[model samples]
Target: MGGTVTLRRALLATTAATVLAFLPNTAQAAVSYPDPQPITGQQIIHDPTVVRLKSGGYVAYSTGGVIGARLSKDLKHWDDAGNAFAEPPSWWYEYNDTGDPWAPDISYRDGTYWLYYAVSSWGTNHSAIGVATSPSGRPGTWTDHGKVFTSEKTDTWNAIDPAIIKTDGRLWMTFGSYWTGIRMVQLDRTTGKAVQGATVHHLATRPDAPYAVEGPYIVKHGRYYYLFASYDQCCAGVNSTYKIRVGRSTSVTGPYVDSTGKPLLEGGGDLLLEGHGRYIGTGGESVFRAKGHDWLAYHYYDADDEGTPKLGLNQLHWKENGWPIAL
Candidate 1:
């Protein structure tokens, strides 16, 4: 996610009074809207994944500092918990000398919390997927599990945004951003590592789109695997044109399709969200269902002030056709 500051036109004196006068009536009306809450601690918090901890509190992890953690009770207000993985693993420094921590996906299974992160330079094919572990999803107590997958510098496809899904007693990882498109590989459950003989399968791509497609996240609901991704350039301030798009398939390794029956593998995706209001370039989505409602956490460039990218959270509602619409 990026950092941004949005400046709304200050309410005029008359408008303020009018709004206040109708506030009580509006509050009594049927629909209730969630107030926008800003999360602190880091300037940019991208690719955020929020999970309900065993203790009932919430832990949110995102890119930057190999992943930063924040805690919340009500899910609206957040308190920074600091960087989860501050020190780069020895192998990471040995290979790249510097760590460009991108997207991180955290999950709990088999008595441990697994953190899958991407290490690579922006817009480059030189990247690798790695795993880390923590007894609990807290800060300052993670152990790196070395590299899981790597892309050759010669390959066009860059591997990043590692999201893991466990199904039918097997673990599978979906990854890839720039260069080629989204790819997936099976992972060893015990080690949280890629299986030796597993080959990366091309899951989705949009090479012909205006820009490269990336930031692949998957959420399985009902009988379908929902594949969500950001399309176009991100982090370009006001000029950025990033937006979230999605498709779904019955099978994990799919020929996913949009509502209009366009296949994702064939460069088809239904638009989930785009820029609006003072927000520009909204993408890099991570979805969570909490309090009986779906919420979308993503980053976007704030355009009101000098454009800065920042994390954004909004409620997600599903249309009758099974597609998500962010409010």
Candidate 2:
């Protein structure tokens, strides 16, 4: 889910690269590597989920009114295709006054392209996660499937920030934000909705007051299932403390742990990305596997651009030791 950005924070932090030198705790876990890989095509998006087109191109969808969409044939040149919704769905108005969908997720299921998004207002847990289907994976072709799950302000956990992955021949969705942490439930393969018989499992959380962890994206690699998420404060523009973290477990419904063997439920995670130089608040991410490489898709606030959030992609390289590193 997109966090609320404060206009004032954008004014406070100018050189994100400089502040990391003083984040003592992150020193042991966060990568210190420079962002040397070239990223081309300037465009703006948030919580973007990307799927490669059959034509060897890539299409991305993200959170916004009618859902912002973009396409790229070669990763170097980007074209704003338009919003995924030709007109705002009537259902979204129940949760979001502006009809802006958040944290859109895309995946291929059988012969269909499935997109899942959150219809929710900022700072409130009153929300709904809706599903849509597209035959060609294009913007206007999508048919909204209505609500998959809904959470109220009285619920124990906020339901938002959805990521769906097919593992062990079953589809599972993990979602939550700023409530009781990350939660997962099984989805009916036929309907792509939560299986009524399956139990909801609480996956990860931060025990502190605000418990600032959310945006769960899981990927199975080798024998382990890696869980990635955002941690700390977000949406504060340049002062956004959002960063990506990872934990792993042998089971999909996990007891995931970080590099230090601490359980994710206890706030354990190995830092992946944080603000550095102009790349501020790098989180709300998704992973896509193609060409023998895993690509991380997310958003970052560009300090040079007055903290405007934009899309980001980087290759994940697994070290000989089996840990993933952004190279």
Candidate 3:
């Protein structure tokens, strides 16, 4: 999510291949992207999830106290709607000094809107995932449902960056940041928490040092389910190397492979979008279908604006081979 990143961490070393993303001689060189749409008013957001409300407006939830909110009638322009919580949720203080939440996931089912969020200390495995439900999906009406899942200091996986997908009548949440990459678990449809006995499934990881993959978002197209994630460092203004990458599988739960036959479990992926011109470290995304198009909504550091975080939207298209490409 958008926060102050020290210069040292923002300049972390990139893997050999990711280094090629910026060099002209490398085969893995990035695919050029058209300039991202310039968002106006109430533009600061991190790890944003945009959802269209039934009442006919758009709501965007992001990282911070009460799960920071922004509302828009047209999605092109936005206005700050204050935090989703009127007061702090005491439970979140167990993991972080502030009862602030981060990386919220927004979804609606059975006439109720569900907002899943994370609480954690920066760069630590200690974290908890929580949920709140709203009757109208508007700010100030959500009720905190408390922790859905959590990770401790000893756990290999960090529990943050939550995203959910309902497939085959089941709701599954995908989360994690630094520790063991991205992991998923099934949630009880009735409670929106982890199913009593369901196992946590590992989805993606980088074996090399400074693994750096996070922000897992899954979306299905045609007959395949695709996993989207951020690669490398983020929150570093224009210095952040974060980019969106993708892999696919016919089954949502197992064995996601990239375009070149590399498994995501071992860091395989096909590039979707990367830095271009004023847009740098373009990642931390959410995907949703709108008006017959699949949209990849993410945040980017605007190089021209003192490297501040801003909302970025791009139309995602699928190829004949079924791979997702961001335009």
Candidate 4:
């Protein structure tokens, strides 16, 4: 009887071990993504905005003279779709076109693809925002809407990086950089232009902070309008201190507060992401939802090289309290 009991006990122990080996660990399943690879159609693809095409593919547009579409069936391993905007629209160059086309925020609205762009001559106040419409986001077809807005030296700020958000049955644009932080103005729904007599409000500012804040991207989620912008100096190679910061408010107009309950217009921004390892100054951010998950696409100066900026993407996870964290 004792020998039989010993054998049974050993068999039970063996069975437990086998079951444990086959069981999946809950911790390892939480974080899983394919190893990241550099996006195609290079030459500083900064401030990337991605969207899903009607046929179920993805296209991304960014800064520089670098406006090209990428064909991504699964949001990974992209193929170049060639140049989306070959030249600055005549209306834009009629005034000034010195800065090499900065951020391009493309969105589908009113049965058309709207492409909002920025132009400037380096640090001068000649900066302006312009718009172009295309039947599709593909290359070789774009109609210029002329200059939408411009800045003067007296304004004490440069106008660039225009992000359009339609809220409450009306359209609004948020844009600015360096000299005066980020600002927003209401736009006419019919013409898609800034509404006259609409007051532009100071959204966020951090001049005294290490770097200036730019790249204003607004997304409405769960009854809150989240304002995302890049803080600090970007594109300084290894010396770049750029990072993404965010604030949110229930009302679209005023009083955006950070995680600390401090107003962003008063220089309070909750830090979202910064450089890590060979990546430096991960700024120029645009957020998108894909495959039932939110993702952030931005650019960073590569650590492997000295001064080249490359595209970087990471999934954005939100907490129960409604703040976004990069996963």
Candidate 5:
């Protein structure tokens, strides 16, 4: 009787362990991500922010070459349209010696196209976010508007990867990098620069040191404001660990939390999309609306094509629970 009881107990323990092995964890669970939509032509880009133009078609602005530009008629086959500026703005040299700009955000507002971009040396917190205006959302039409915001080495937040949104009739820009994660500041409606004496608001950060979250792009869907950000190391080609994560809050300035009710500041973000198969290091994401649907635009390191960072686009779907799923 004792031997039979021991055997039964051991069998139950083994079955329990097997079931536990298949359970999901926050960071390492096996979640299959869909591949990016097929794209062709000049696909190489980094930190892409796409916007549908008022005139026609689509344009993408990204890091490198005085805010590199790519134009597409159908959002499928992209063509390199050269740098947005003929030369780097004179003031951009104050932060970076080369005047090399990075991670531009472009949007059309009130009959004018606004361009916000960053200038900073690699691995430094001394940075500046600059704004420009374009009569037409074309490569060479942008007129530099000088620095909209800046951050020094003494600051906890690194000012880069600028993303803009308007809510409650006020303009706000969310920007940050590795130092303290994502942050936000109110902008002047007319000038499009950070308001004088504006209170800088903390948005998201990892609990651990060297907090890796950055590239914050917020979109209001239904009743919740969804904050999309890239997490982990980037620009290392195939070895990069970059992936996209998200959290949502009712307020524009959030105590944003993941689907599990964990705060983003506490390293709580639901994994929206990540590297899988040949598309390695998928990150640097932004959202845009076109054809009556929301679309996600980002860049991914293509392992099959020498790990070149290229454009990745996917349709975003909202679940019944109001969470976003990238299809």
Candidate 6:
């Protein structure tokens, strides 16, 4: 979900261009990505995952400052809410020297908030995704629950950028990065960790090297499971090549395919959003429902602001064919 400006040269430009070139005629003919809605105050963030709190308003956690947090009472103007944790748990040090966590997914169920995030040093596959619980879904209210999953140097899949989706009474986590793209495993609802002997399902990957795909977020719409993932380089300020793409499948664990019936495992996904105008490197996305509408939350490097990463929010609209468009 993160990389230096140097990694921006990884394999993705051609892949993204190919995908967009083959977009459905309906979409391609009218292809104009929308700009994120304007917002005020504390717009800085990366890899943002958002949740609507029952207590009120919304809380967003992203990659930085002990899981950086932001608050929005009306989903417009935002204020820095401080880090989610006052201090990292002792276990976080095992993965990163600074205990710095990244790419958190927040969900509310059964009267509590569950937060899943990754801890790893840059440019390595040795990583771990951990879980925590919060009573209020606010900063400073979390209780760290340690690792839900991990990936050693020997593992092909890097277990970062964790996102959770519950389907048919089963809890599943989808994660991975440059090593092998997106993967999924069932989680025990009780422990919020991988289920004993669970099979890790391959969800998405690129046909090229460095994979260049990360930050997966899945949501079910109609009869299909839509997999949204960030592709190409990120964290490189204005030089970042990050963009968002999508594919869908009839099953939760898929062989997901883009609008053209191409498998995501083979670098197939419909273009959703990418850097445009002042909004550069539009990726690291998460989707949530609030006030009877679906919204896509992500981060973009601001070309107008010295390439500082900032929050990007857009309403999601599903076409008659069930593909989603960010507006």
Flag regions of model 3 displaced more than 4 Å. 1-31
* Candidate 3 local lDDT, 1-327, one digit each (tens): 334443332343123324443443213444346455546789888889989889988899998557889998876799999989998789989988878788899999999999999999887888999999999999999999999999998888999999999999999999989786989999999999999877989889998855789999999888899999999999999899999888889988868988788899898887778888888998999997776778889999989999988888876756546776565
- Order of the predicted models by lDDT, top scorer first: 6, 5, 3, 2, 1, 4
- Per-candidate Cα lDDT values, in order, are 0.75, 0.82, 0.84, 0.74, 0.89, 0.90
* Candidate 4 residue runs with Cα over 4 Å from true position: 1-44, 94-99, 207-211
Q: Show model 6 residue runs off by greater than 4 Å.
A: 1-30
On residues 250-317, what C-alpha lDDT tens digit does candidate 4 reach at each position?
A: 98876899867888977887777787778788888898878897888888888788758777777665
TM-score of 1: 0.83
Which residues of candidate 2, in runs, are more than 4 Å off? 1-31
Q: Whole-model lDDT, candidate 6? A: 0.90
Q: What is the lDDT of residue 244 in candidate 4?
A: 83
Q: Name every residue pair that clashes in candidate 5.
A: none
What lDDT does model 1 reach? Answer: 0.75
Candidate 5 residues lying further than 4 Å off, grouped into runs, are: 1-31
Across 122-145, the per-residue lDDT of candidate 2 in tens digits comes to 889998888999888888889998
| Model 2 poorest ten-residue lDDT run | 8-17
TM-score per model over all chains: 0.83, 0.89, 0.90, 0.84, 0.91, 0.92
Candidate with maximal lDDT: 6
State the displacement of the C-alpha of residue 53, model 3, in Å, after optimal TM-score superposition.
0.7
Superposed on all Cα atoms, the candidates' RMSDs to the truth, in angstroms, are: 8.0, 7.9, 8.3, 9.9, 10.4, 8.1
| Top-TM-score structure, candidate number | 6
Range of the 10 consecutive residues with the lowest summed lDDT in candidate 1 = 25-34
lDDT of 4 at 60: 81
Tens digits of per-residue lDDT, candidate 6, 1-327, equal 346642542344334334545555237426577778778989999999999988899999999999999999988889999999999999999998999999999998778899999999999999999999988999999999888989999988999999999999999999999998999999999989999888989989999899999999999999999999999999999999999999999999998999889999999998899999999999999999987989999999999999999999987877657888776
Steric clash pairs (candidate 4): 211-232
